[model samples]
Target chain A: MEQEKRPEEVKKTSARKWTESAKKVRGLVANMYLRAITEDKPVAWVMFTLCNELFVAMDVLPVYPENYAGLCATKRVGDPFIDRAEADGYSNVTCSYARIGLGYSALWRDTGEIPPFAPDGGMARPIMLVGSSLVCDTRYKWFQAFSRYLDVPYYAFDMPGPPAVTAHRPDVREQYMKYNLTQLHGLVSFMEERLGKKMDWDKLDEIVRRAEKSYRLWYDAYMMAGRAVPCPFPAEDSFRCFVPAFFMIGEQEALDFYQGLYDEIKYKVDNKIGSLPEERYRLLWGGGLPPWHTMGIFNYVEDRGALFVFQSVYLPLNPADIPDRITNPLERLVYSRYEMGIRRAEHDRKLGLFGACNFVGLGNPLLFVDEFKVDGVVMHWLRSCRGATIGQIYQKRLLAERSNLPVLFVESDMCDIRDYFEADWKMKFDAFLETLETRKRAGA
Target chain B: MYFAGVDIGSTMTKVVIMDEEVIASVIGPTGAEHRRLANRVMEEVLRQVNLPFDEISYVVATGYGRINVPFADRQITEITCHARGVYSLFPTVRTAIDIGGQDAKGIKISNGKVVGFVMNDKCAAGTGRFLEVIADALGVRLEEMGELSMNSRNRAKISSTCTIFAEQEVVSRISEGVSIEDILAGLHEAIASRVYRMAERLKIEPDVVLTGGVAKNIGVVKAMEEQIGFPLLIPQEPLLTGAIGAALLGKELTLKAVEGGKPVERGTRRLEEATFFE
Candidate 1:
């Protein structure tokens, strides 16, 4: 009772708990993003996950510079970014995200919004910058510049090549994986030292379990959409389903949230309450999420007696629930979840598309088409998404020849309302439908 | 007499059987495993109406997965199916935009048939996948994205032309503290711009019909309208327009086949049998 606890001891205890809390938060966030990546949950969910994780980790926020660049394009931000990057010797077409990010950085520097690292916000600076070498080589180089400029750590995750086309060449992937893992481990160790704490393996494991449960529950909800009446869960809401992915992946709270969601969805399914009006067609959707402004497609189809029964949102593999490898904790850390594997696989596929001189042919639309059994395909040709637009001709031809199915191609953006012309689309579609009827009558 | 249209899209298979008196339809996943699902959906539709499958006159199949439909009497390209579907739904439709999960097609129509079509089958940028990617990035539900987007007074521009890159871009924007509404607006505009390019290439005129999964997105519809400077005719059930057209065609064919007194083929008969119960 007479012995007073030293200030140092008190500080140590506080630091340990603080670091533990942070790890738990980061773990959950990581799990969500990892699941999104593994299951190809959606780009938005994945980004949210990443941002949350970075914030929890107390690291510099990882911004998707490309999104900002896109805004610039429509908002006239592109010109300044392009001009700035070019003036700095970056090419005009050097991955617009990089240009925009740099431009924003320059703007921030001028505005004093971003200051050098210190304990306070005004003085705090980024300690590290991370980039994935999945989409383009430009990001790799661009992040390098950031690393040098900020005088902070720069980490690049190398993605594998396509297994289908590359014949399973794992050298590049292995090298990248190893490098990324090494760097990640070092980062964690540095963080532990700075916080004067060791990682709590038990807590990490608990977080992972929560993430897995949440993912399963969300998946069950999506499955309910296949019922006759279907659930009101629109494919557009798929991103929101990943909320647990952004913040609670490895936490007990995340598990509880998902469990609750699962119960709600189960109740709906049990009640036979379809998401759309009771009608005849129970169509499945493939490809990416339908844009918000264009949600009318669901109502339009549903009104005509069709329901989106299934979708490719079910494609991602579940997170592995197996215990971490005691012998190689780093391996567990690197490949702890299946999302990373999925991301790597997708990244490789994108690389192949880029290499094939068809940078836009990144996603395999035919894969979803064949898997989902859609009666007719409505291919949304988004102007801003080159990756989804490259292989349309080939896919269409294949579908026509192989499936003898109807494919409707509509051109529009996911977010912008200005680019969609209802009158034009309606006239074309009406005639197209008429022809389908005629063909049916003619027995073509 | 009834007509039927069977559209086997990449994601799901659909069958529409329309009689002068009523219309019945069925949809299910399309795949090697879908033969049974298709049969079940068809059977269910017919069962609802207490109709016999044999009553259907003609059956036309369209879509990427159409060939897998064992019950279809004839197979037609999605282009033809959409053309027929659009024409039947809106006889005045001169142009059509059919956006599915995987591909996008812009067709010029005349007299209820496809005349000239410009399509993008190479990538998924302008397709539902693009929106899927963006929706995923924003952590918004696909269904709620449209509503949220509509709430946005400011539109954020998303420049990554590639789905993957655009996803990354979206992440960066969020981290930078850009409002989600702005990002959504930007994304919608990007999609519209792409479609506008295609329409320009196709020399699209007014009286356009917007069909497919993407047409359900109000933001995209409004964006397209703004970009093309024209009004759009959206069918009550835009996604099923192709299937509806196909069903109508099926009815016409069945009636013709019955009138001709030529015994319907086994495949046609099977489709009729499967779908007539409703």
Candidate 2:
């Protein structure tokens, strides 16, 4: 077969460009998509919330619809897909990622061919579709809908409740863990049966180790750069930095990418290089996925001299500590996932952080207001995606009650542009910056 | 020591020239090309005071087209401008609700400084534009809505979520032989309730000031007062408050710069009709 050409590059809407790791990941992801489309590798349609480490071990190239939806949005090609879905009776207020994903799938189903202009040559048709009852509520149903369109088998893994809930109920915790382990075993059997491939235990162990190292590097980079005086790694850059830990996890490339990121960030910190020329105000991206289409809003804020130092959404999951006694790779993988979830929950409980399914919200921004030295919190209140948006009002109230850190809720959708009004949003943002200036002057 | 402020809003452009007190002010419609209209409004205000452009010590721009005024020393958001403007008039004012052409915002102020604020979302509900759309559909003049609404004993209910739907509801009510006065009253009630609910987010305090083009509508002020459970203190010319505040802020900035032994950085005082070609 002839070499698959790389898709045309998407333009950067924001002033701050993606970090080096992100640029590399873009190529790697494009290659993965091309390879899967050409049937050069086994493919699995996956969601971001699931642990793709298993797919890595199985040698299946995992393609994420959520990531593709985000890309389409960033590339400004999401509107048609979203409009198509909405026209077909999908509620406009449902999860936009699901709408874009489903719409893309429908186009393929109807045409029996991938849309030529689809972002990243569109996602590869999977041998099996995967979902997780994790952070987002729309995953299982969305994947189920996709299975119907693609006529492929679908499977969903159930995540246990927050660690805070399980802390008090040991029996419930035991049952939940048992169920999760059974699901993992079932997933392995299902994969083996469907793909006619055996589990590579040693390869899985090596991958798990690599995933752990990548996660550690990601955590260290965020902690070091995130806490810097001027915040060398702003949220805009960190969003891209998340690609390695999120998509390429459990791979040697993931480890290399993060290491390079750590080195780059450390150098920036050491050289006193900041994301902005003058970071007058440090802010926390309060919660919810950003409006990918207008992500340049981050640059807009930065232009006003307010830098987003930390955000809870894209924070890396806590790396799991595997017991040395557990020699089996399967046991290690299951235990690692369970430990990551529980440990994160416990940490969040200690820090008074809000919990979201999957590992979305692990820490509270208010708790780190002093530590991060943030003067304000700007939360994107997505019209769709209720899972990320719930409790934001209460969180703002809590911020007011606990700290003087002002919270600005910028209401928009994660993918849909219709939910955003540029003039109204700019006015709101300008006013928010003024409030921050006034508060700073009054020494509040 | 003249300081001028130009406020280019979505539907109106206002300019205020002041020295210790307001000397001259101009209010005019903001046309399709607001940038050019902004210059004309500024020129008119300067003409009213019979002062050359160079005589004004500082010029500050505010409102939606705040940045478009090339001759202004600095541009401030309407939120801050409104708060400062209201606070200057009512020193004890703790909260200010400004419903403008396209958006309605509630500003929480303390000791002449803005502490917090909440504004309407992407929707035009409870905004001046919302009322205008409904009024257009009802074939009623914008200025007469307040008087007409007051005459209604039984007002019809209108949805506050979408302007188009609200207009449809108004049309349907009219088709049902409902009085236009009653429908106008309902529209006032809908907008009033929406703005009041938004202001409540800031924990509405007493001595609340209402400033904006919408405040001129007596019907809205009365409806707002009823919902807020407090009398709203409105300025003599509500539309000019942002411009007034901008001018005052410019004066303050200039004074502060001088007091700190620093140069007051300002743009060239070239007040001319603005052109897109520039």
Give the whole-model CA lDDT for all candidates, comma-separated. Answer: 0.56, 0.81
Candidate 1, B1-278: lDDT as tens digits:
66667776656667677766336766666655664457666777778777776765566777765555666777666776787788887888888998777677887777876655776635678888899888977888777766677888778878766788888898899999988978887888888788778766566887988988788888888889999898888877677877887776666555666789966553634542233224
TM (chain A) per model: 0.59, 0.92
Judged by DockQ cut-offs, the docking class of candidate 2 is medium
Q: What is candidate 2's lDDT per residue for A1-444, written digit by digit as tens?
A: 011222356567643563565456567767767877887778999887547788999989898888888888888788767766776789999899999888888777767878666877778878998888877678889999999989999988776554454543578556766787787788888889988989998888888778878888998888887788867888877777787677778978888889999998888889888878888888888788888887788888777888888877777756667779977766766666666766666756665664633555434565467778888898888999898888687777778877867888788898887898777778788888888888887787
lDDT of 2 by residue, B11-61 (tens): 889999999999999888887776575777777878887998889899999
Give all TM-scores, in the order shown.
0.46, 0.94
Q: After superposition, how far is residue A154 of candidate 2 from its true place, in Å?
A: 1.4
Interface RMSD of 2: 1.1
For each candidate in turn, the interface RMSD (Å) is 9.2, 1.1
TM-score of chain A of 2: 0.92
lDDT of 1 by residue, A1-444 (tens): 101111121111011111111224334434433443344212221121121232233322333444334333333324444455556786544545565556445544544454121101111244445565443456677767765545556655543333434423566445545765666566556545544567655555444444556666655655554342554454434333444554334455666766665666567667876555553443445443344344445555554455555544323333444454433444554443323344434543553432221112234444444444445555666554444444565556655666755666676654334446554454335434544445455555
